[model samples]
Target: MSTLQDSGEKPSIYLHRLQVALSVTIKRGGISPEKADQHLLKQFCRGCWDNSLIADLQLEQKKMNPPSFAELLLLLRTEEDKCTAKATRMKQHLGASKQRVLSHSQRAWMSSESEPDVETTETTPSQEQRKSSSAISQPRTTTSKTQRGKPKPWYCFTCGEDGHIASACDNEPNSVLVTTKRKQLKEKQRLWESQNPSADQSPHMAFIQTNGL
Candidate 1:
């Protein structure tokens, strides 16, 4: 609702959009026709930038209620038309008044300035005619002091070596030295499985059960 606004939209345009939104909500079975009408009217009023028009409609609504939503829209539309017409008339009048004053002032100024320079005189527009023609127009290039560092060297984590990556390293992982117990566990499991020919347990399950896993 905070985002809902008429902007320059006519009441009918705004109402059309509002009806589209309300139709979906109304079909979901909570809001009735009368409640929806109230919401539409309230939100339309809230969305309108013309406070005077909304106030007038609200006043007339209190004095004599509209028979339907269409009737209410008719009332609002009538008020909007009247306000628009009045504003147009006021703007025209103001513009005409300003025009009259401007013309009178212009006449006085022109009469005073007419003695100084004649229109028949020709003056060279040296400054306006002077334009620059570039031999080579290129995009600007800038070098910053912050870009002074040399690129760091590449190193392999596999064998603690430089100049090559880990993926290309030929040596086996040095981590195998730390996991010697894992190798022992695998060897013992293989031996036990060979000894017990009728084992039906899951992989490593027999090893874990027989040992202190």
Candidate 2:
């Protein structure tokens, strides 16, 4: 009997022993009597007499039961192959997806790079041409006769003459006949107030008197 301490094996060896013992117990009592017999036979071939030989003996016993061992190993191998195939397929699919995404991004970048940028072009004529054109067009405009090299006459509002405006007119009736009658009235009031110094009235009182309050 090889002790774990003597063999310098890990403590896990003890755990493995416990697992084997439990497995044997469950096998012998967990099933029908006939199944227990088969289990016992199986254990004998497995050489599971002690913990030290458990793993190696189990492999040997499985070989002795060739049909069952082959079937179980084949199934496990097939399942592992299937898992490997699935993992490979998934990795390839992801790679293709990434390539497609990168291709699309590159195409978009290229399209933007290939596009032409539009710019506005401004062209202004020379200053001399602009000045000449302005000078040529100015004389074509019509000017008033009085403003065309002739002094304008002042019109008298009283007699409809052209000597002086109503303000400078000597005739009182002519001043009253001015086109700006309101201005003429204000000027007349100002003159009257200047001549008469005795007029003493507040603006509010004047407003009330005018309104007949």
Query: What is the TM-score of each predicted model, taking all chains together?
Result: 0.38, 0.18
Clashing pairs in 1: none
Q: How many backbone clashes does candidate 2 have?
A: 1
Q: Which stretches of candidate 2 lie over 4 Å from their true place?
A: 1-23, 26-28, 32-70, 96-213
Top lDDT model: 1
Lowest lDDT 10-residue stretch of candidate 2: 144-153
* Residue lDDT tens for model 2, 94-160: 5433433443322121222222222112345478765765565454332221112111112344543
Please give the TM-score that candidate 2 achieves against the real structure.
0.18
The superposed Cα distance between candidate 2 and the true structure at residue 155, in angstroms, equals 99
